[model samples]
Target chain A: MSATEGFLHGLQLAFTPELLLTALIAAFVGTLIGVLPGLGAVAGAAIALPLTFMFDPVVGLVLIAGIYVGAQYGGSTGSILLNIPGDSTAVVATFDGYPMAQKGRAGPALAITAIGAFIASTIGLVFIVYSSGFVASFAITFNAVDYFALTAGGLLILARISGGTLAQGLLPMILGVVIATVGMESTSSYPRYTFGNLDLTLGIHIAVLAVGIYGVSEILYLIEDKRQRASYKKIRIKDLVPSRSEIRQSWGPWGRGSILGFILGTLPMPSATISTFVSYRMEKGIARNKSQFGKGAVQGLAGPEAANNSAAIGSIVPVLVLGLPFSAVLALMISAMIVHGIQPGPLMMEQQPDLFWSVIGALAIANVMLLVLNIPMIGIWVRILQIPRYILIPVIVLVASMGVFSVSNNMVNLYLMLALGAVGYFLRKYNYSLASMLVGFVLGPLIEDNFVRGMRVSQGDPAYFLSSTFAVVIWSVVVLIVIGAAVRTLLKRRAQRRLLDSTAK
Target chain B: MTLEPRTEHEAEPGGENLETPPEEHVEGRRSGSVVFATLSLVLAVGYVWMAFDMPNGTSGDPGPGTWPRVTGIAWVGISVLALIESLKVVRTAPADLFPTGKSLKLVAFFSAATVAYVILLPILGAYIVSSVYMFYVIGLLRSKWDIRGGIYAVVFGVGASLIFIELLQVRLVAFPW
Candidate 1:
């Protein structure tokens, strides 16, 4: 079947009454976490990820993917109305969204952003719908050595480019590889880091570690801060409605931003700061009210919002196709897939078309759901902001701790979560980038084992990477990413210095 | 080609003039971060060293600890660089750092309560061990006063016990001394 036909079929499945209801629930719950500043989609997906173990991996993955997109859209609710960016990505929304709110134009801001997110999301979903099978097919052919080279390339990209200290990034990751080595050598029956404990026979569960490090640490974050008392402001219900002129103005950016966001989000080396900046600049340059930009431009809000959301979609492209996660959050998503016995890569399209298409379709529905729900539930989303953190975190902690505990019924897993929580706390304190470390922890084993095994098979001849033209092409691309990021950073610094000097004169 | 709008504080990112240490009062304390990092570095290096002795690829070939050992060394190397960079006292209160003391104490108190639960689990059974432990942990974190905290603790504890031990079929030691 053609890719378009496949997407249409997936849509038919997604739009069924049962799936529709599920999408709505996912959006509502996702919005709840998204609007609450400290909580995020990653945490939301994870907290709910364990619950999906009993379900079909495709259904489970779709639900989580819906929540993932839904959360990004909902996050703007906090940023626009409350003036607090829900997460780093949503920070740009506040540039114009808050200003719109302050002017009692929050309705238009909400409408436009929701509208923009939905449009951008549709664009991204369409991209995934077409490309997932192609990408998945490519990954199925990766032998151990090819897998190794890709892993090494990915590790370096994740480490150097993952937006934290290269050293700090590798620490937990390298430690994880050592930890993975503990139970037994995967190929041989030899034990390495077990310290001779009988329980060590079974390797550490990456899921439990992710649940603790990413999931539970979030609760710790909430507990450390003063509980957020939901506060309300001048939110005129009328503000939820957008003017015709406003809608017309927002349309262009939504289209442009969707394309921009998709590319940025998909790239291994992100242009996060710039994607928004570029969108903001592009919209402003073309916008009639150019001078109003920085003051309160609606286009400013639409462009960046589109860019970031598209990037989120873009980020998923590589994962569905190649079984490679360019970011930490995606790494966790890959883990979730692994737990369900559904390996993602090229073969998955033929092996599990239902899963691939459902995920893409689910994202599409999530965006539509966001548009449908954003305005009517503005009051509900706003009200949820006031839920006290004191009560919230304990429940969260209880759920996470209990989830980890129940998985293996291992009393040891609960204790492990506690210990990892402390280590995470310290890592945060030092401004060491947890993202790279997380990326490392997730990708460390994949890269190391694959590269080593592949090397061994090649008998130290590095031409193993070149035997297949595909490997050569991928490595070359990875090399380009590394060089580009290096050059970009250097140039960015130079530009900043020159700007500073010019301003000084 | 365009500029990112940055906050003033973010500029002069690495200039020593931005955060000169109070050398007189806090010399050793200031150095603690680096010292701790170095110690971790040593430990990481040790792990890598041990990895070196690990057997390389079998007859068909797959080296035992080659990847972990190499990664460990790389990790150590990265730490050394970060240590030097971090010593400057940039004074930017980086977000996502350690919690304040009171909250930390409460966090520890809950952790200690869990430890107590682990110790008591075999002796007291799943229900009893979890019951008292939950109550104690919540009380330590935030006392709602009176029976509210108690109610929450008991409810959660009971829910946990049934879900974990009864429904999921975890082995719950029922015998207590």
Candidate 2:
């Protein structure tokens, strides 16, 4: 179907009463998830996944998409109100947002965040809707060699930018690829790591892995730390509307952030956090009086929040077009799609056009719903933080277990969930990149499949890796990213040495 | 490219930065890196050994084992690099692992209780098992337990029933008997 036709049909599906209610419920859950520290969009998706099973496929997708999109907007609440980031990406928001709250402008900071997220998501969605069709069409034309190059290049870029030392990120990624190879070898149908256990033949379900990592591990992490809940200042709806000066200061940052976020998100990396940081830095650099930064600067609040939401939408583009998940949350979405027996790829747009368009439409509507829900309910969101951790954490665990068990009604998956949860907990403690591992797990099979196919086509010529111009371009980009990281690390070490030497002298 | 995103004021997973003495902090980090790298090296060696046992078809006709072997080699190379980098850090200072006793105990108990709850689900059913598990958790976490705490646990465990069984129509594993 054409983009316009798909969109129109999606409008029809998304606006239906059942799906509209699903959007509202998802937005509500996403907002709540965003309000709590240590609970991210991935966790929210995992916890709420079981509930979606009862709904129609489109409605379920809409709900999950809504939660993912809404959580990004919702995270600013905790950041602005309590100096706690609801999402890790919102960490940048706390620099300016908390200060605004301290200065009696909490209302305006939140208003701008919500508004920024709304506008940026709309802009990002427009690009996604228009470009996705083209991406899918172009992807369909690509052969095995091109596929191999793109996926391999994407993985390399992901490893480099997975938000830690390259080695730290690559370790988890390698582990994920190894884990992906556990149950059954695609080529020979031979079990590699199943240890002769029949239950392992079906492989670890993606939902099981996701729920374990995001849901159970997060609980484990939260329980280990004893943190006092932040006190909330009573807020009124009237206080949430932004002032004209604040609104004026926000427009330029919003525009710039949306563009930057979309472009970065479309790239094969974890873009939300990176985009927010980049937007925050860009705003700081361009501001007339930089001292206002971290001191309730509206531009600081505006740009990062806008960039974050835009990147959230931008990340969905690859998931739809290439069936590649760049982040943990997107991986869960793909798992949800797979659960419903719908494969997410370029062909999905062609074969399941209505389902595809409805998801896009649902995300667009979810963005609007967040703006509507957040402004009036800002007071309630603040109050949500007041819920005691002892009470809340138990409920989360129960829900997590139920969600995992509900997927297949098996007890072994519960065991697997616990085991992986332990792995995730330790990985986080050691500052390993869980997101990189997740991306690796999702993309590992695709990479191996494409590589094997391309090799078969080339008659196993090792030189086929660099044969095509496209392959060469991809490899060049991969090499450049690696070299760039190495150079930066070296420069940093040298700078540190010079500083240390000067201090010693 | 400059990947040091964790500046002094940046919020990490647990919100507050660890406020160890400067020397201790540096040494502690080095020890942590070394430990992780050593563990990764062991795992990589095991994986590579397994890869060696697999059938390696000719380059012209790659087998299922071929890609795993390639990945295994890559893992070894990177693991060695990681070990070297970690050793460089360790050269600066060496510190033993620090443990917060209470927190570790609490985490271990919490994890164990969860495992027990899941194990008992088929025998005792979700309602009874989760309610007891929730009660234990909330009681353990909260300093002074009130009857209301038990009520809350019961409600949560029962709420799972209402949603998963009644609302969603899932035939959750109940009493095995």
Candidate 3:
């Protein structure tokens, strides 16, 4: 089919009544998850994964994608109203958004955020349409060696940039890969880590692990923290419309942030969080009246909100094109696709163009739904903030347990989920990168398969890895990243030593 | 726009604004890192030993063990590094890392309760177990036990069971005929 025809078909598929209803429900749930503290996109999606299994692959994928976009839009509401960021990506919003609320301009701040997110998501969707085809086509030519380099190099870069020291990130990731090594090996059907147990040979499910790590662990953490209810004044519908001056102030930041976010989101980084910080910095650096920022500048609120949503949308391109998930949330999406027997890489466009285009169409539809839902339902979201932990926590626990149990109807999986949840809670307390661990778990098998295939093709010659220019370039980039990290660490330590010595004198 | 000075409550880019652990609990965190590193070191050694037991064929005909072997070796090296880094500044009594006794009790109670729920699920069925579990947890989480918690719990339990078992046909254990 022609590109235009595929695009049109996708829109048709997404516009069906059943699919539209799915998108609407997903949007509402996603926003609710995002507005609630202690639940981010990853946890939200993981918990919702089992529900999607009842539908066809296209509908399941659209549900996941809708949740993703809706969460990005909803995260700002908590930041604006309570000075509490719903997630890390919403932290920047709290800087100006909360201040605006304190000044009784919360309505305008939320309006601008919704408008910016809508525009930015639209831009991101356009880019996804144009760029995915080109990227996928190029990826279609990748050999096993190239694939290995890409996956390995991407994991390494993610480890380096995923925060904390390299070892901290790498450890959890390596452990995840080790976890993936269980059950039967694909090529030889050899069970490596089963240890003579029949159940062990079946391997761990990605959904089980995701729900355990993100959903169950989050519940434990929230229980320990005992999140207090936030007080919020009711927002009427009329109060939600932005004034002419506020609208004028937001346009420039929104455009710039959208572009910046899209570019960064395509890379293997925590793009949503990083893009917001970068956009905030850019706005601060370029603003004419700098003093207006912390006190409640529309530009400050608009830029980061735009960047957060755009980056969330833009991150999907890599997953669809290369089957490389750069974030934890996208990793879950890839897992869902795999569960549905849909391979998400370059060949997917040829094999499942309808699914691919329909996802894009779903995202656009979800974005519009968010814009429409968020403004009129501002009062409801605020009430959600007031929900007591006693009520919220139990509901989440029930849902998570039920979700995991329903997937396999096995008691063992529930036991495993509980154990993993305990482990995840500790890991999180120590600041380990769960995102890195999740991405590694998803990509580990792909890396091993590619490596083995490349080795077999090349008769075990190690030089074959460097034979291709793409592989060579990828390895070079990996080396550069390592060296850069080492140098930065050394310089930081040296600076610390100098300060200590001077203080001693 | 002037950049706002970061406050203590503000979350970092890749982190959240969790409450600070108590002064006594701070030492436990430090020692907890050491314990974790030691455990990881032991796990790595065991994994490496197991990896060697499997057949690792030559480069041309790599066995299922080849990737795990390489990963196991890398794991050993990284674990050693982690251990060293963790030990560099270890100072504190090896107490439990929970910030408060209340928090510890809450986590322990919930964990135990969940374990019990799982055990009872297949026997008593999902609806009965889930309702009781939710009711108990809600009462525990609330400052004082109330009838409202019971209502919410029953609604949630039956509502969830109906949606998953009836509407979605999820094949969950339901009421015994």
Model number with the top DockQ: 3
Candidate 1: TM-score, chain B only = 0.67
lDDT of 1 by residue, B1-177 (tens): 111221121112111122333454234433555775777688778777777778865434557766666667776776676576456433344332344577777666655665576667766876676667666666666654448778877787778677756675555664474
Per-residue lDDT over A1-505 for candidate 1, one digit per residue giving the tens place of the 0 to 100 score: 6799878777877876767777878787777877887776767676766655655676666667667777777888877777776665677787888788778787788878777877887888888877766666666677876776676666666555543433444455555555555567666666776678755666666556666666666666666664335456645567678888778778889999989888877665443434666788788888888888866787899898887777777888877887777665677678778888987877777778877777777667777787778777787777777775545655565556555655566767766666766665566554444555556666766775666666777777667767876677767876775566556655655676688789999
Error of model 1, residue A391, in angstroms: 0.6
Count: clashes, candidate 1: 24
Ranking by lDDT: 3, 2, 1
- TM-score of each candidate structure, all chains considered together: 0.85, 0.93, 0.95
Query: Fraction of reference contacts reproduced per prediction?
Result: 0.25, 0.37, 0.56
DockQ (C-alpha based) per candidate is 0.26, 0.33, 0.43
- For model 2, the chain A TM-score is 0.96
Question: What are the Cα lDDT values of the candidates?
Answer: 0.67, 0.79, 0.83
Residue range B1-177, candidate 3, lDDT tens digits: 122321222124333222334657555666777788789889988988988888888989999889999888888887787777555532232233354788878888888888898888888878998889888999888855678989988999888877877887777778755
TM-score of chain B of 2: 0.73
Ranking by TM-score: 3, 2, 1
lDDT of 2 by residue, A1-505 (tens): 6677788788887897877788888889888898877788888887787667766788878878788888998888877887777778888998898889889999999999999999999999999889998899888877777777887788777877773555766777777777777777876787776778887877887767877877887787677655676667788988887889999999999999999999988887878888998999999999997999989999999999999999999999988888878888887777677778888889988898888988888877777789899999888888897788887888888888877777767777889998888777766655667877787887788888887776777888878877778888988998888667767766767776788789999
| Tens-digit lDDT string for candidate 3 (A1-505) | 7666777778888998988998899899888888987788889998898777768998888888888888888888988988877777888999899899888898989989988999999999888888888899899999998999999888888876774655667787887788889889998888988899877677887778888888888887778763456678889988888889999999999999998999889988889989999999999999998999888988999999999899998999889989999998898899889989999999888888878888888877888899989988989998897788887887887788888877776777788888888778777776667888889889999999998998999999988988889999999998888657667765766676688789999
RMSD of each: 5.2, 3.9, 3.3
Decide which is better by TM-score, 1 or 2: 2
Q: How well is candidate 3 docked (DockQ)?
A: 0.43
Measured with C-alpha atoms, the lDDT of residue A215 in candidate 3 is 88
